[model samples]
Target: MAKKTKPIRPPADPLPPVIAPRVSAPPDPMSIDPEIQKMADDLSAKVHSPARDLELVDEFLDLYRRVFQQGNPIGLNEDITAVLTGRNARNGILFPPASPLIVKGQLVDRWGTPYWFHPNSSYQMEIRSAGPDKNLFTQDDVVKNPGPDNMGIGVGISQP
Candidate 1:
């Protein structure tokens, strides 16, 4: 009687090691270039008190326009506060990090709440204020959606 032999199985390929996605830390405010710091100070000094929602929205629109004129590409996923304050200033500095408008490294509203920024595209951004209530997404919340034309010489506002 012939002895039954077990079939030899080939070794299975080892699974690849999982690599975690790399997340970059936010830029340090103190490490900003001196030239950019000077530019931000100059621009920040020109900003007037934004008491109304329209003013706040207009401020953001004007910034976009200036960035466009500088020939810098707007980052759709970039933080507006960082971009404005020279931390992640891809479009150059437009606001000073030590300005009164910035509270705890955020761009605050008239009520001292951080403004929420939504970048719809390279040429479109939505600036939202918590309004007088200091709460967002309510009837009192003010949202201004500035489109592509506003980044040019033209100005327009879209509400959503």
Candidate 2:
């Protein structure tokens, strides 16, 4: 009979030594710029609604009109917007000589959905979008048009 021998140990990983992951330091909020912070706040406001309310729909509709139709007779829509936004100022004269318009925020409904602009006439356009239900071409959709005494109508809107 032969004597029993102890089992041999397996070799360890033949690579770099294992090291613990380095923890990152916390960021300093004070390092942020006021203007950038304000822009962030404005963007956040645009993506969300107050009390989840869509009261800004009317304001958005009015802005679309002024941006799309209120341009000078000979001014292109792009030129008008660029001028309004202080871009391509050389074309600014193409826009109305009156005080230039500056639209704020994004072209979105109160629900953060982009408003659809369907041009049906030279001076009139149909700006619409899905309302709170988030369904397009439905009764719960908002619609606004050109002309005096303009009013927006949709299912999500509560008429007083």
Candidate 3:
């Protein structure tokens, strides 16, 4: 029978101090990025439940395409939050009574990318997650619009 052996230990050396690359940092008391501050301000103003936001984005796109006859495409970037919340030029709340109001505003996705909402035109907007890559418009981007394929938005709908 083969005998088990204890692994030899290397000469004792002090362990290095733990350091990690922080993708995000706590807001400095005296300093803040304007873009991050914008996100914070938007969120603090009035956040909505993520589920509700999803429904709202989908519905808004559907209406613009189906009802308005504008054939608007959804390709949001970041400012779409203002459009949806009526903080933009539009005065009407397209989706009102923001449901399950838990978040103060557009919530950040898992990858730390804020839900970008950009209005391409009056009839079109795009909303998406930066995905794991944390970059917009990449192969990994989680698009809310789902483009022409609709990314299997519902049953019977299929993407190639």
Give the candidate number with the greatest lDDT: 1
lDDT of each: 0.57, 0.42, 0.47
Per-residue lDDT of model 1, residues 1-160, tens digit only? 9999999999999999999899998875456566555544443454543334445444545665676564223443235566665554354555555667677777776677777665656555666666677776655666666445434523322354
Q: Which regions of candidate 1 fall more than 4 Å away from where they truly are?
A: 1-65, 68-78, 89-91, 146-160
Which residue ranges in model 2 land beyond 4 Å of their true spot? Answer: 1-106, 146-160
Candidate 2 local distance difference test against the native: 0.42
Models 1 onward score TM values of: 0.48, 0.33, 0.34
When summed lDDT is taken over every stretch of 10 residues in candidate 2, the lowest stretch is 92-101
Ranking by lDDT: 1, 3, 2
RMSD of 2: 16.0
TM accuracy, model 2: 0.33
Candidate 1 RMSD to the correct structure: 12.7
lDDT of 3 by residue, 3-53 (tens): 999999989999999998778875543343354344434434437543344
**Ranked candidates (TM-score, high to low):** 1, 3, 2
Residue 12 of model 3, lDDT score: 95
